[model samples]
Structure formats: structure tokens, C-alpha cells
Target: MTAKQELKKSIIASVWFMFLTFPIMVIKVNTVTHTIDWRWHNMALVGIGSFFLSMLWRYLLKKKEEGGKKDKKAGLSFIQRLLQEKQFALPGILIITLITILFPHIFSMYQTNIMTSALIFVVLGLGLNIVIGLAGLLVLGYAAFFAVGAYSYALLNLHYGVGFWIALPIGGILAALFGILLGYPVLRLRGDYLAIVTLGFGEIIRLVLENWNEFSFGPSGIKNIPKPGFFGIEMSMQTTTIYVFYIVVLLVVFTIFVINRLKNSRIGRAWVALKDDEIASQAMGIDKAKTKLRAFALGATWAGMAGVVFAAKTTFINPASFTLWESVIILCTVVLGGMGSIAGVIAGALLLILLPEYMRDFGEFRMITFGAVLILMMIFRPGGMIEDVRKTYKFEK
Candidate 1:
């Protein structure tokens, strides 16, 4: 590349990184407890600054391209070549780890709490991506499995006094069973019918929690849930043990690794085929029932793990938290962030969840503004802000 082109690329990349990192830093510091007095004003400036910087960068890049001044593609240096590969995600992961470790006290407890929540939702979004994106299943009651896992942890720990560690996998097993059970009955259903059935399933789970006071404790829900301990090491404010972050980080990594593996396996190919055309998949010797069930079970298991983290972090479980709206919002994350892309799903969840948290000062208008944005997203970028690596956006005019 020419020196000018190289300089422009470096500036644009640095500015884009700034756009991403600054908001996270500002949002982390602007919580309910550490509430900055001029929080909204600062946030507005951040939004405007980020907007102009990004626009200017884009404009410069486009103008250069339009000028027909072709810059030679530079051969990558050794380090640059390594980073240019798909394994760049590893270096990014290491950088995030270093940030969390080096500046542990950069955030307050509340900020840590919200970051933990974002991590959990990231897992949830990844799990849902398996079924809805790869397998093309329309599961409206994804939170039913989430409920199953949370309630399983709550009830197992509350009544039986089981430790958080043991109850997590148990919660997962129960959710898998529920998924298989649900999948068996709905394997023949498609589209709107399948959605309706899953919707009913979510409601059924919620209503069961409501009416079954004998065990579930009804609307009162369950409390005093135990926090997770790492290898017998207890996490507390004084201990300086970043167990929550570590546990969540490990689970997120594991989920991504496993999902990526599965997405490339034989079963994964079968799922894609089934999604594309059930009849053709069946013609190719893929068993529809088994493939569908596998997708459901895998997705449910991941969500169950997320539920374990959710329960531990909150230290309380309630039916109110796993409502229909929660399921819809999760779906929105998958939809708005490019379905089938794990990284995109995480980006989508972080954006959707954190945006509202930061905009709490807007009162009722916060939701109004959010709704308008969603409508615009659907109209203008229905495939999401980022297109899948395998897909391209084609505009019909």
C-alpha cells in the first residue's frame, strides 16, 4: 500500500477501535450507584463524537476508493500475516483477558455485575444461534429451557441444599430432557405452527411456576440462591478473586469452541441441509427427527449453562425474569445481529442489553426511541448490521 493509504487505514482502524472501546468504558462507569450527575450529557457527547468520527472515517475511505487511485496491496509482515488469519480471535481473547486482569479495579461492583450479565446473555445468544440460525428452527420458548435451568438450580439448591457446581450440570440435563421432549412432538410442525407451539410451551412453564406452589413456591419464587465457588475458592468483595469473570469467560469460550466444532461436523451439515429443505435432507439419508432433536438439545444445554451463571450472579430466582418478552428480546438479538454468526450474536446482545441500561435516564422515551430504532433496523438492515461471511446483501432497486 502507498504511505498515504497505509496511514489512512491505520487511522480508520484506530478510530473504529476507539468507537468500540470508549462506549464500554463510559457505560461501565455510569451505573446506578456510581451515577455521574451529568451522565446523560456525557453519554450524548460520546454518541455524537463516535458518530462523527465513524462517518468521517467512512467518508475518507469512500472518497479514496472513488478517486480511482488504486493502492497496491502490501505484503503482510510476519506478525501481520499471523493476525490476518482466522485465529486472530485468540489474540483478541488474550487482550480482553489482559485488560480484565491488569485493571481489575477499573470497575465498581455494579459494573462488574452488568458485565457479568452481558457475558451470560452472550452465551444465551450463542446457544440460540445454534437452533434458530444454523438449524433454522423457530423456537419462541427458548426461555423455557432457561427457566428450567434456573428453576432446577433454585429448587435443587434450596430444597436439597445441593452445591452450585453440581446443580449446574443437573440443570443442564433436565433442560436437555425438556428439549428432547419438546422437539419430539414438534418435529413435524413448521413455520407459524412451530412458533405457536413453542410460545405455548413458554407460557406453560411460566404458568406451572405460578400455580405449582407446592414445589415451585408460585409467584413468590425462590431466594437465597447460592453463589458459585471455584474449586472450593469462595468469591467475595474482599477476596479479589475474579471468579465470576473467569467462570463466565471460560464458559463463553467453551460454548464458542463447541458450537464452532459442531457447526463443521457431519451433524452440522445435516442441520443445514434440513434447514434448507427437509425433503432433500431426508433424501440424503439424514433423519429429520433425530437431527431436529439434536439441535434442540444442544441449544438447550448451552442455555442451561448460561442459566447456572445467571442464577449464581443474581443470588435469586424468579418467574418474572423469564417472561415472554425476555424470549422475544433474545430472538431480537439473534435477528438484529446476523443469525448464524456467533460473534455477531454477541455484538447484538451487548448492544441491545447495554443500550437500554445506559438509557434509563430517558424515562418512557427510552423505550420509544428504542422501538423506533428497531423499526428502522428491520426496514433498512433486516439481515443485521453485519452480514454473515457466507452471505451478501443484495439491494433490489
Candidate 2:
């Protein structure tokens, strides 16, 4: 589309979005007086911000398109080509690793904790990328598997005295089993219907955990969850944070490694094929049922691992923690980063998590800001912040 046409579309979308969200954005709950108040200033800011953001998006997109056309004709520059090559990338990876190792020492405890949380979501996002990004499946309830993993570890530790080491794999196995079970029933469904079923499945798991208080402790949740040990080493507050950070960093690295390997595997190619054209994939001799099942199982496996870490870190977990919103946020991370790009997933997780935490002073308006950012992202970069050029899918205009 031309720049002018894109700008016009952006303006229309901005206005429509403002109209739809005005009530929520403008109206505020008064906790002191138990009344509602209108924030006209906030509403005006949102309206103006959305318009400018839309225009900026159009401008950037036009530049990106033009750049792509130019690059095709002249090829890439030396620096660009070097960065794309593995020789440059490996040293860059080493530098990032060194920074991650020193992050806790450089930052405050609170900041370190936030980084830990972001890494957790990085793992979650990578896992979901397998299903949504690579396999092109719409799983609205991915957090269900995460909850299953957390609860598995929690209950096992509480009742059977299973430590983090044993419980971690067990939790992942259970979640994977649940993923396969969920996949079996929804094998015939696709797109919206599949999404609806998965969403319902997630809610069902949450409701079950909530109501089955005899086992799950219901809304009160499980507490006194054990922290992981360093081969039975004693853990202090500072040491615990360091341990969690290192463990999570390792998990994130492992996740990225596995995902990259999968992306290049025959199975990964089949997933992309299935994602792009299920009918054609079937005609090409791919087993649709098996492919989908593996995607679901593997995705749930990482979520399960993340759940274990979450439970250990917090030492508490409840059904409330595994809401649909969690799934949505993880999905957002995957989409915000380039869907199929591992680096993009990490960037998305860090940006989405840390950005909101740093903007906590905005209070409730921060969410509105976040929503606006997401809207802008979807409008201008539907392929995500980093586009995965290796794969292509049909896009509807």
C-alpha cells in the first residue's frame, strides 16, 4: 500500500479503537469514595497518542518496504552480511552470556527478580512459539499446561515429599500428557473452533483446581513450596536469587537451543508445511494427527518446566496465577517478537515484562498504554518486531 493510503487506514483504525476503548480508558473507579470518575485528560492523551503512533507506524513500514526492495537489487552490505553470518553471531552470544552472568551483581535485588521473571516468560513464549508460531495452531489456553506443571510440583512436594529435581520432570511429563489428551479431542477442529475448545479446556482445568479444594486447596492455593537446591547446598536470600537467575538463564538457553534445532529439523519443516497448508501437507505424506500432537506436547513441556520454576521461586501458587490472561500475555510475547524467531521471542519477553514493570508509576493507565502499543504493533508489524524471513504464510489483506 502507498504511504498515504496506509496513513489514512491508520487514522481510521485509531479513531475506531479510541471509540471502542473510550469508556474503559476515561472511566475510573474511585476506591476512596466508592464512585466512578471521568478522566478526560487521560482520554484526550490516548486519542492523540494513538493518532501519532499510527502515523509513525505508517512511516516506518514504508521505509522498511523500500529498504527491502533496495536490498533485493543491490544485495546486503558487508556489516549486514557479517552480522547474518554465524562467526559474528557466536561472539555476540558470548557477550550476552557474560552480561547475563553479571546482571545480578550489577543490578539491585528487585531488578534481578524482574529479570528472572522475564526469563521465565521467555521460556513460556518459546514453548508457545512451537505451537502457534511454528505449527500455526491457535492455543488460547496454553497456561493450562503451565498450571498443571506448577500444581503437579506443588502437590507432589506437599504430599509425597518430591523434591524439585524429580518433580520438575514429572510435572513436565504430566503436562505433556494433558497436551496430548487435549490434542486428541480437538484433532478435527481448526482455527476459531480449535481456539474455543482450547480456551474452554483451560478454563475447565482452572475451575477444577478451584473447586477441588480437598486436593488443590481451591482458591487458597498451595504454599510452602520448596526452593531448588544446588546439590543440597544451603540457600540464603541472595544465594537463592542468584541460583534462580542462573537456572532460569540456563533454561532459557536450553529452550532457545532446542527451538532452533527443531526449526531446522524435518519435523519443523513438516510443521511449517502444515501451518501454511494443511491440505497440501497431508497430500505430501505428512501425518497431520501426529504432527499436531507433537507440537502440543512439546509446547506444553516447556510451559511445564516454567511452572516448576515459578512454584519454586514464589514458594506459592494458586489457580488465580494461571488465568487466561497469563496465556494471552505469553501469546503476546510470541507475537510481539517475530513468531518463529527465537531471538525475537526473547526480545519480546524482556520488552513486554520489563517495560510494564518500569512504567508502574502510570498505575492503571499503564495497561491502556500497553494496549495501545500492542494495537500499534499489530497494525504496522503484523509479522512481529522481528520478521522470520525463512518461512512464509498466507496473509489476508
Candidate 3:
């Protein structure tokens, strides 16, 4: 499109946004004085911002379209080629490793804590990556399994004095069992139907936790939970914060390793097959029941582990923390990051979590900007920030 045409479209968008935002941003009411105030500046700001943003959006959309055409002609993208070749991959890996080791030392305790939370989501995103990205299963109740893990640790420690070490694996196992429980009856379902069932299942978990006073502490939540111990040594809050960062770092590495291995394994291929064509996979002698169960179980294991870490990190547990919104955020990470791509999910988690955090300084506009960013991303890049590069094999006859 010509610049003149683009300019007209942007102006139209700006007018529309100004009109839409006028009722909320431009109008303010005072209860005590029973008076009304008009904020014209807010309206002007919205108009200007929308005008510039629309232009940027169109420019990005055009660039993406052009780049897609070029990439198709070039076969493998540069990043994909680097991934396939080991020599180029090592230096990148080493640099990232060095950064990971120095992150806590370079940042503040608050920053480290925030990063730990993001890493927890990185693990969560990976877990969901298996279900949604790999097996093409829509799991709306993922945070339900997350709740299972957090509660597993909380109740175990509160009742029997079980430590973090013992509770970690237990959390994973329990979450896996929950995953199986969810996957069993839904084995035959697909698409929207599967999503609805999972959504209902998630609500069930949340409602049960909310009402089950005798079991889950009835939404009052459990608190004063202990952090992980290191060789029976007691550490200060700062030290413990750093320790938790490293622990989550290790978990992220472990999650990536295991997930990468799973992506290349036989079952991994089975999952891809199931995702591509469930009926065809069933016809190809693949057991639909078993494969779906395995996907749910294995994918949920990571959520459970992350939940355990979450409980330890926050030293608290509540049904509110594992609500549907939390699950949505987790799902967004996988979807926004590029499903089936580890690096993408990690980047998504960091961007979604950390960016909003840093944006807190924007006050009320923080969420506004965040939501706008998401909308732009969905419009411009539906496949995610980094799409999963499919593996190709050559056959000789």
C-alpha cells in the first residue's frame, strides 16, 4: 500500500480508538462531590498513540509477509540451519550458560525473585507445550494440575513435616495422576469439545479447592511454608532467594533437555503424528488411548514440579493462585512463544512475565500496554514469536 493510503487508514483507526476510549479514559466521576470531570488529554493521547501504533503495525505486517516469502525461497532459515549444525550451536550455548550463571550476581534480590517466577512459568510453558504444542491436545485445566502439585507440597509439609526435597517428586507424581485422570475420559474427544471438557475440569478443581475446607483449607490457604534446604544449612532471605534462582535455573535446563529428547524420540514422533492427524495416527496402529494418556501424564509432570517450587518460593498456597486466569497466562506463554519450540516458550514466558513486571511503573497503563502488545502479536504473528521448525528427512530409493 502507498504511504498516503496508510496515513488515511491510521487516521481512521485513531478516530475509532479515540471514540472508544472516550467513555472510559476521558470521563471521570467523583462520588463524594457527585461531580463529573472530562480529561481531554487522555483522549488526545489515545488518538496519537493509536495513529502511530497502526502505522507501526502495518509496517511490521508488511515486513513479516515479505520475510515469509524470502524464507520459503531460502529453504531453512538461518536460525534453523544453526540449530541443525552443531559447530554454530556450541558458542551460542556457552554464551547463554555464562549469562545464566551471572544473572543473580548482576541483578538485585527483587529481580532474582522475579526471574525465578518467570522460570517457573518457563517450566509450566514447556509442560503445556507437550500437551498443546506436541500432541495437539487442548488442556484448559493445566493449572488444576499445578494446584495439585502446590497442595501436595503444602499439605505434606503442614501435616507430616515433609521437606521440599521429598515433596518435589511427590508433587510431580500426583500431578501426573491428575493428568491421567483428566485424559482418560477425554481420549475420544477433540478440538472445541476437548477444550470445553478441560475447561469444566479446571473449574471443578478450583471449586473443590474453594469449598473443601476440611481438605484444602477452604481457600483461606496454607502459609508459612518452608523454603528448600541446602545440606541442613540455614540461609538468609537473600541467600535463599539466590539459591532458589539457581534451583529453578537447573530445572529449566533439565526441562529443556528432557523435552528436547522427548521431541526426537519415537513417542515424540507419535505425538506429532497424533497432532497432525489423530484419526490417521489411530489408523496407523498407534494406540490413541495410551498416547493421549502419556502426553497428559508426562506434560503435567513439569507443572507439578513447578508448582512445588512455587509453593516453596512463595511459602504459601491458595486456590486463588491457581485460578483459570493463571492457566490462561501459562497457555499464552506456549501459544505466544511458538508451540513445540523450547526457546520460543522460554522467550514467551520471560516476555509475558518480566515485561509486565517492568511495566508496573506505567501504573494503570501497564495492563493496557500489555494487552495492546498481545493483540498486536496475535495479529502480526499468529504462529508465535518463533515457530517450531519441523524436522525433514530425505529418503533414497
Which ranking of candidates, highest lDDT first?
Answer: 3, 2, 1
Which candidate leads in lDDT?
3
Output candidate 2 Cα RMSD: 6.2
For each candidate in turn, the TM-score is 0.75, 0.84, 0.89
Residue 81 alpha-carbon offset, candidate 3, angstroms: 4.6
Q: Give the per-residue lDDT digits (tens) of candidate 2, residues 1-397.
A: 7868877887787788778788889888999999999888876777778888878866787776776676442543443344467678989889998999999999998999999999999999999999999999999999999999999999999999999989888988999999999999888888899999999999999999999989899999999998998889887999899889999999899998999999988999999999999999999999999999999999999999999999998999999999999999999999998788787788898999999999999899999999999998887667787666463356999
Candidate 3 structure, TM-score to reference:
0.89
Pairs in clash, predicted candidate 1: none
Question: Could you give candidate 1's per-residue lDDT for residues 166-209 as a string of tens digits?
Answer: 98888888888999989999999988899999999999999899
Predicted model with the maximum TM-score: 3
- What are the per-residue Cα lDDT tens digits for candidate 3 across 1-397? 8889999999999999999889999999988899988899999999999999999989988987887777463744455566778687889899999998999999999999999999999999999999999999988889999999999999999999999999999999999999999999999899889989999998999999999999988889999999999999989999999999999999999999999999988899999999999889989999989999999999999999999999999998889999899889999999898889887899899999999899888899998888888887888778788778877778999
Q: Candidate 1: what lDDT?
A: 0.79
What's the distance in Å from true for residue 72, model 2? 4.8
Q: List the residue pairs that clash in candidate 2.
A: none
- lDDT winner, 1 or 2: 2
The regions of model 1 sitting more than 4 angstroms off are: 1-90, 102-104, 231-235, 238-241, 391-397
